[model samples]
Target: MTAAFAATPAFAKDVIVQMKNQGAASAMVFEPSFVQAMPGDTVKFVPTDKSHSAQTIPSMLPAGVAPVIGKMNQEMSIKVDKPGLYGVACKPHTSMGMVALIQVGKGPSANLATARAVKLPPLAAKRMNPMLAKAR
Candidate 1:
């Protein structure tokens, strides 16, 4: 009987994504590289600092495309209706490791872990090194 009830999506994973500011000059990404959500599953992005946002976009999105940036609301939730790889990033600090790869459903339509290894633009690289050095 318990097993029958468990078949519902009530047990689907709920993730809390956090954005934290470490200092006046630096911030950090506390999001996971891979998150799995079923169709109807929800994910929350919480801002732990004054100026941070979690935005979702298509995988391999072009540079100028606008992302779905989450605001500093009291609470926020995102429902997954499609099975695909979603790219997440912080608007102002994405190059500083403020990026996440969300996999909806049982598998990712595209793998973004390797994309993380792609070389950053020269400016993005310059902005990221200082924060990374501090983290180390």
Candidate 2:
């Protein structure tokens, strides 16, 4: 079974999303890209000594919520305010297929259909398959 935030009372919890490279190819990626969160949860995107900026995809954000963008390792903390799926990408490394998915709220799911229908680039499409499959 997947993790559910409903069982826990709403509170401020922080989840760190690391922007780094892995293996020989030095494939840039968002460590633990697929994350489960609740409203009021804070997702922080952290980069190494290098550069990386986090931003929400317009089409992938929930309805009525404004998209968020964070500067490099200098400043990055997204406070979720609604229950839905959020798509995050590294503005500089998106072409390298760097992407992340965040689910906010209880179990079952919310705004997933809309989130899945979003169109992504080739590399992103490939890396996102497994992440999306596990969302619930």
Candidate 3:
């Protein structure tokens, strides 16, 4: 006699990123600004303070992925299905260097260079440079 067992499917995880008024490194920042996630994982942007929103940088998106913009003080979740780097910014505070990086899957992607080449405001660039360097 043969016995049969039910198979359980793997579940996707939700990664939480907090938008804070003050972080350990700076003010008006995304705490844990750099995240590494697998494809299919969901990133939840939680606004811990008022006037903070999470929006995607167009030049940093993977091919076929649409840009996302969250309303200020609202919680937004994004499912990362593509394998590449994604750059996020706080619309109200981007000029103050409020930015983040999310690298999905392994290895560098084709658009990494393109993302790097996109010009950003001086302060935003300063904050993003280190996060970009950590990708891959």
Candidate 4:
């Protein structure tokens, strides 16, 4: 883990959402369901492939919020001082179950809402799939 990962505040720890060579579909869903963070937490989405990206959209987020695009492995930071669920996903693989759930607080239920899971366009898999495998 890098200093940034460890330096994550007690309330929030740096979480890594890693993409796999299995293809864009694999990158879509994080093996672990819930990524925990605090008020000022930073999460890094390390795309195995350069084409992959982690983006947030208002439609995807809770009400009264706008989506922010965080480039893969770009070291984006998030502050959830208030209480709510944040939704995230991969643009290329949204069609193929590539969704992430971020819980920003410690309490009863995170109550994070689910985002639309999309299936990887067959061609998208063909284009981005091998790029990741070669990286490994």
> For this target, which candidate reaches the highest lDDT against the unseen true structure?
3
lDDT of candidate model 3 versus the reference: 0.88
Over 25-118, each residue of candidate 3 has an lDDT whose tens digit, in order, gives 8898998899988888999999998999999998898999999999989997889988898999999999999999899888677678877887
Best TM-score among the predictions, by candidate number: 3
- Per-candidate TM vs. native? 0.59, 0.83, 0.91, 0.57
Indicate whether candidate 2 or candidate 3 has the larger TM-score.
Answer: 3
Off by over 4 Å in 3: 1-11
Q: Write the per-residue lDDT of candidate 4 for residues 1-136, one digit (tens) a residue.
A: 6887766665545677765435433444543434666567776666654555677534434455556787754534445444445556567666665555565556332333223332335644443343222221
- lDDT on C-alpha atoms for all candidate structures: 0.56, 0.80, 0.88, 0.52
Cα deviation in Å at residue 73, candidate 1? 6.7
> If both were scored by lDDT, which would come out higher, candidate 1 or candidate 2?
2
What is the overall TM-score of model 2 with all chains considered together?
Answer: 0.83
Window of ten residues with lowest summed lDDT in model 1: 127-136
Residue 26 error for model 4, in Å? 4.7
Mind giving the per-residue lDDT tens digits that candidate 2 earns over 17-70?
888866233488888778999888899988864777889988887788799988
Q: Against the true structure, candidate 1 has what lDDT?
A: 0.56
RMSD of 4: 9.7
